[model samples]
Target chain A: MTALDTARPGISPTAAASEVEAQGRGGGGGPSRRKVGRVLTWLALTALAVLFIYPFVWLLSASFKPRGEVFDNRLLPKTFTFENYIAVWQEAPMALWLFNTLLVTVLATVAVTISSSMVAWGFAYFRFRGRKYLFGVVLATMMLPQAVTMIPVFLIWESVGMTGTLTPLWAGNLFGSAFYIFLLRQFFLGLPRELFDAAKIDGASNWQIFTRIALPLCKPALVVTAIFEFQAAWTDLMRPLIYLRDSDTFTVPRGLKSLVDQFGFGGEWHWEILITASVISTIPMIILFFVGQRYFVQGIATTGTKG
Target chain B: MAVAADTSVTDSPPGRPPRRSSARSRETRAALLFISPWLIGFAVFTAYPVIYTGYLSLTDYDVINDPSFVGMENFRALLEDPKVALALQNTFIFAVLSVPTQLIVSFFLAVLLNRAGRASGFFRTAFFLPKMTPPVAIGILLLLLFNGQNGLINEALGWFGIDGPDWTTDPVWVKPGLVMMSLWTIGASVVILLAALRNVPQELYDAARVDGAGWWRQTTHVTIPMISGALFFILIVDTIAAFQSFTEAYTAFFGSGNTTYSNDAALFYAIYLFQQAFEFLHMGYASAMAWILFAIVLVVTLIQVRVTKRFVYYEGEQR
Candidate 1:
């Protein structure tokens, strides 16, 4: 009997007898079945993988193909060119949009990651009256949909005269998100208490412990949070649309939106232009996912298990 | 014994450091430093607006003109405002219908991808790309997809001798049009739920099988509990996100001829709020609407938190 057979008391022997009746490892044994299973598994998987990945591949390839050949069903490009990409950059405020999106996402991610780590440390390690209740209050904000806050936030932004610029973009992150806070808190909680006691014995303050100890330990989870924050702020359409009025300041998603305004079929600004922009916009995120897929996978798996 | 007693005494000196006092002082300072941004943002952006809107709902305050207080008027006026009632009703209906479908579709898709194995990453990213795609871009793509004449969907329907509803123009189909569009993004939640599913201890499944438990029973007893936490989180978040729907509603269109397309069927709370705040410039009234939104979300969220605890089974905890 094989190792897997240990659990199946009655069936293992019966299955084994049936297996012996057929042949040896040629086709009867569990190992052979596993091999067949693996092959079939791989075949099925490869098909699914292709289906998932082909659309984006086609999209990117189409972006490079000539405008006349854009919708052609050919998987390979007959005439490849960078002209579409260049024209998208030259024709519209694509550069401005890229610059604005990068600045906003980068700054916002930095603010959120640092502040979330700091606040999360406070929640994780500190002991004070109403601390539990206050933490609960923090988690409470997460449950409220951002839509409900739209008018209220807009009114407040208008009153402060911070509505139009890139101010709202990164500024909101400085306040931190409940998810990020809870994320770091859980990671910190999972860590052994001895480390904190060791730091305390050395006469290190909470800030020292936070900066030198807890923060470093939670790097994996924090990196995931940073990536998430970056992606969120970068690709956001709703907030930028509501707040930004000026064309010069439009973020990438917002800029892409303006491309469709009253425009008809394939002109200089049609299929080729929009397709190229879409490919360009998704490149960074795709790259981000590939580079950190492991940590990203782990991050999603472990986050918010406690609360 | 003497040496052990000496070690015990030495473990903590009689005059131990005054960590309690220091920690208390440090906590106060740390809290102030750590919370400064949230304090500012909440006070300036959230708290102020929430309070101001509550106050504003009772008054006629135009930015260009002087303020006037009128109590219970906006609430009474809201009852009479068909638009407000319509928007609220539409928002709830849209959320109620869409959230469950999105959740089930995503979970099942995750199941498919998970079992599909080697192709999982490609499918995961594929599914997730649309979620990451700009809503404007999606709205544009979906616009093409839903077009009655040449659009892909109707064209497919035509082959079966079924002339699909004019999705853009028909009031009956307009909301469903948005719901279909919303599905493009469930890939995000799918990614999340998929990850959670991976953490379901394989040994538990193995144990169930040894006990002759089938797939469905195994899922119910073992797999469900392992990842129920993540499922709950996503459900609550999805509900909130669904209710907050906008942008898509606004982007949907037929032609200038129909204006609002058979009826104002596409209008939801956020769209209506946008119109009130920016288009119509009813600043005070919109602020009041914001407060009502806050209350509704708060109550809903609280009930969810209160109730979900009963249904969700953590790894080791008993029901």
Candidate 2:
């Protein structure tokens, strides 16, 4: 068993043994039968894993193949070349798109993380009137479908003359998303009240206590919130699709959409470049997942169990 | 000790009640100050927009002209629009098929991972990497893999002597193809259900075994009930998400200026709504569509909560 087993209780070794035994041949299986069962389970899992991972592997390999060889269905490219990756930049403004996506993602992630944690701290720490009702409003916002607000929110940005710019994509995040606020509030509530009380008695102002105490204590949650928001901002296509009319302002997903339009069916038929761009766009997220695998698992577990 | 410390900060000399109230008010003020961002955001982004959507639905307003009141006209048009019905039907089909399949598949995947011991982490990561892929990328993958001819999926099917249908070009197979693509991201649900599975009490399974329950019996009786909460949560969430499915289908079928594919089969409700509001600039009609969708989601979610309450076993609830 790994740290995950110990972190979560109830999945002891004997329990696992019993689980395997229960899954054995009708509770009267010999040791050989159980061993066969284990091998079959492993084989089944390996096949499923291959099914899940093969497409990406194909995409990754296809990115390196020559244009006509892109659909040849070989996992290994017969003629490997880096020309696709080199040509992708010349064919499209991928560098600008990457820069735009990075900027927007950073701004949006920081804005949402700080703003949501503050609001969550207020909800979790303070005893204020109408707190329950206000928090209910936050939760209710989570239920309200974005389709309902998509038009008017667009109109709001249009009226402000920011629709054609990148402002509409990241600006709304300054207000703190309801989902992140709710998640952070759970983290804040898990904190002991005495930490803040001790900070209070030491003459720390509310802001100082929030910055110095609550923020530090909830670093894992903060990181989770930031990473979640980063992924949201980076992968978000809808907001950019609506707001960005100019290719210059396009994020990676929007750029990828345009690439699909250009290459897939718009008669360019350059499948290699399109596949390369997809691989390029996917690499950062995969890398982040590997680096932050622990936090990702922890964050997902908390959201599931706590909810 | 923490309670005593907490009270020490709030405790005042008995004669000074006004000071206590003032301190309480100060804390309240600080709290409000801290939460002011959400307050302002709620009013601007959520509250105002929702109320305005309600008003907008009743009028025919293009972007250039002021919204003129046509009360009930937009709603009436929605009823008459054939595309509206088609979109709704398509969305319903997608949701009904996708949600249950995703739930069951993810549950079993979680159960398998739960028993995989040392190999669980690698399998989980492999499964979850797809979920982390951007939806736009997934849309591109859908096009690449599900293409009618020479796609990887069809090539793989040919190995088993089964010819795959033209997924993107054929109207009948479009939504089913999308459902298959949606399963690629079941890793999230699997992770959630795995967490729930790990928390299930071992004794319940032991007791079930003592009663001579086998794998399927113990699963149906003990394992499922223990993780029913997570299952129900994924059901509601995935249902909502399925209704809002746009990015992938849009990118695959409609994102390009080219519309030579089977757009009708892929025209999900949100995609239709998006086209009306953004592409055609029919703000009022789209608003009306939005409200209808809102109502449908609300009703479906309510029905789910009410129906699942009996079956979902909360650990500490009074039986």
Candidate 3:
């Protein structure tokens, strides 16, 4: 906590901070060490940020460079070209992978949006015999690690004859991830009771109430669920690896993995082509957030609180 | 007030009075309709597989041939499997090494990002983007960095007059390299923790400051306890995830190579199970390994929940 503590060279940053701040000497010698401390902290933070971001920069720059120059330590390539984009495009079925991800993601997003809200509405208003148990079951699934259930699910998907198609991919998430179900249920449970009561008093059907009142009021939760689904559908590697066999059905991640294999033993390393493919895979996601950026904060804010 | 209208009055024998509110029945039907997809899915995908895996854990089920009902033998073999012991030891080490470090780093980064006035979102996004960047891309990126002959990390270290170890080849450095890769995706955890920090009911902050508490005092006593719910949540999930570090390790070190390591370092539990299931085709033994992992997660998570009582703070929950 003082000069004595700083003498221990092995103290990590967390300990150092806790010590300095807790001891009230972090401000430093009025002005001189204070400046030094501030400068050092920012420098450290800047280095960490670069460590985090520089790879993507290298990725972009190397995607344009030749194989020989890929390992070169430079921020920008000596020359830039569209060769990577063209080669990757011509060599692989990037378009098909993009299409597969979009179809499954959109359909699954819609399914999750509707189903989660509906189920959440039921959990909120319904006083059924086993309602609590049902909600508990949905929540419990969130804690069940996907790795544990993965092989079993794989065997089942193969058994159903849905393997090597887009059906298994979307269907797995269409019923909704436990995250969305819990998120929607939390939001729905928070809604005012009188709205449902009024809709019913008007002789509205349960579907009508759900469609008109519940769904309309749940835009935030729906967007949040859709965001989660978009990310999952976009970035998933393992599911498509097993169920999908054909190049035509590959998602972006799986497609990237294929780029390595297609270039077999004799083929040259297409650093440019691979980076461009990786760059393209991230485009839809960036676009999703750019358009849905308003709801992005809302999405993360509401998840995992109740569940 | 939400009672279904007395439509039975006309259908029934001019019932003396309308049946008690049919709301409950309608609600039940609505509940059933709502969860139909999930219920069907649960029955088809989750429920069946969960039970089936449990059944598989007991038998020798290799997909290439019929599953023989060799009860307890698979599990017994699991105990004696040296790889199983090694993998279990490796998993605990990875978890112990990664979880606390990750939590500390992410929380601090979240704290720093939370303090930004104008560029907060930018910093937050910058910090969190790695979590979104495809892990496949990340694997490739790590491979690029860890390459012995020509890697940027080594070149950078060379500039400092120190020779960096061959990150991929060396057994001791391989897992640490994998753990480093895991930290890049701190965005989701940071975002969740940030939200919790934002939720720390500002009154507590004001009260702490009123008592002349500095930022450290305020954070330790007030901010952390208030966000203890989120911290506890991330701790449990992160620890469990650390126990299952696979794809990153699998890709970076063993893209196509077959080694238990020249020194046997990167053979993680999940990776070992992966080799058994897909590569070696020892499905029965792999199933047993998986069950062991499940048991590990269940027991650890249960222990976490139990141990969290002293630290986690739920503002509205009854004491």
Candidate 4:
């Protein structure tokens, strides 16, 4: 099921070609024409793929190159060195920022996954009063942009004396994210209701049924949610900028922003260090994407098609 | 709500009324208990902030002092605010140009990927790499790539006997630069549309072909209608994302010492709002701008929903 198969989709290219083959055998335009067409298509796709992947290659190479060679318009570095990476580490608080980000992303991902799943189970299992209305509330929250609530949310956190701390950043996720809740709710709704009924008949509490049955059945969805929350927390720049006050508290994104400010100014071009810091910040996410690309694509596919 | 309850009661055969009632009440209690976290979150984070923003829009609240009731003064000022008008214009241009362009490009790429045969997995992974890159990192990369003299973009254009615009320095290319950036991460929409295309049944295509429809005709008549729901989904999501575009414009144009006069062209709606609230400390004015943005988004969404009703084909709706 998870093999990333094109088998189920309508008419795979090879399948269509075979159908052409089966029909009239040598009567139709021969297989050579189709072979040429396939070759051209692959060539075009390869070029497009290179267009998409070139930036990362450029970023990685530029990060290792000397300052003068930064904008040399070359794919490979002539004289790559570790000096920029070393400079980035020694000159900036990269380790501290990474630690801060790891702490926030892990905690917030766990919090959002737990809270969203519980709420999703509620909306999925129950036929309560105002259930649809509450789901509408969830949908509305998704539409309400952070820009709309920026000032007042900031004020609320500030009034509570938590502005300069990381509390305001991850604390919001503990409440439940609308997107995660909606995603999990869709997954939960697809689950068989008979399982819940069976658990209930066996004298299982709602909590027990949720912990034992719903959660176990929904591991894929949970993984998707965790990946999403972790990515969001890790890549977030605005929230950290707004909430964090000191360099000691800066996340990777905010710290990287400061790096640009500090080194990318006043006729002093530090592109190597800047790019190095960016590459370092991006490595974890790239790793995460490669590891969980299937889940990520599945989540996007599910959310998109279901909508 | 009452209709569902009444329907359930009427639909029941007989002799199970009390049991159903107890079961329903039990479910309701369990539901409330399970969703308590979200309810508290909704009340604190969503519900209160919405109402509070409305209240703040009516007053002049600086961070240091209590707000004074300003009535429509901020709104009145907003009408004459050039920055507000400029930001709105820039945002409108962005959404109008970028959304359709992105949709077309993503759909085209999706079609290519769909036809990619066995190479689909490798191509999918490669294309999706950009979307996975952090915006901060992308900003830095773009800044270099789009640099006027030595950037790779212009260098590539030179090979085609074309003089590329100074993407970072010129005011004329500022919004276009942002638009280009927006298109670079078209993977999300591609994935969505790919899934949509996969969901399109094979019988529809065969039927269309049997009716003498060519590939283009089949795509237009059958495939598009089938996937209109996903198209509309990307439309709304991308529009909202475009309006709130900040990190790229902020990081690429306005970071530290690179803030030139032309950088004003990159002052998007959210970037402007950030300036007002954080840079200038015009809390009340920024609040008013935020409300206007909210109203614009709400109206746009309602309009899209109305338009979708006319054109979008939901599969289960017909039956």
On the 0 to 100 scale, the lDDT of residue B67 in model 4 is 88
Candidate 1, B-chain TM: 0.86
State the lDDT of candidate 3 residue by residue for A1-112, as single tens digits. Answer: 1121121223343354344443344444544544455455456556767888777787778888876677786888887777778888899988888888888778777777
Backbone clash pairs for candidate 2 read: none
- Report the C-alpha lDDT of model 2 over A117-224, residue by residue, as the tens digit: 999999999998899999998988888889999999999999989988888899899999998898999999889999889988998888899999999999999999
Over the stretch A1-307, how does candidate 4's per-residue lDDT look in tens digits? Answer: 0011223355565676555343322325566656665676678889989999888888899988988999997888999788899999898988999999999999999999999999999988888999999999998889897877888889989989999888888988887899999999999988999988999899887789999999999999999999988889999999988888799999999988888777775347688888899899999999999899999999999999887
TM-score of chain A of each: 0.87, 0.92, 0.81, 0.93
Best candidate, lDDT: 2
Q: By DockQ, rank the candidates, best first.
A: 2, 4, 3, 1
Interface RMSD of 3: 6.8
Candidate 3: CAPRI quality band: acceptable
Place model 4 in a CAPRI quality band: medium
Worst 10 residues of 4 chain A by lDDT: A1-10
Query: Model 3 off-target regions past 4 Å?
Result: A1-47, A262-270, A304-307, B1-18, B201-215, B255-264
Model 2 chain A weakest 10-residue run by lDDT: A1-10
Steric overlap count per candidate: 0, 0, 0, 0
- For each candidate, what TM-score against the reference? 0.81, 0.94, 0.87, 0.94
Cα DockQ of the candidate 3 complex: 0.28
The deviation in Å at residue A286 for candidate 2 is 0.6
Q: Considering TM-score, which of the candidate structures 1 and 3 is the better prediction for this target? A: 3
Error of 4 at B225 (Å): 1.3
Docking class of 1: acceptable
TM-score of predicted structure 4: 0.94
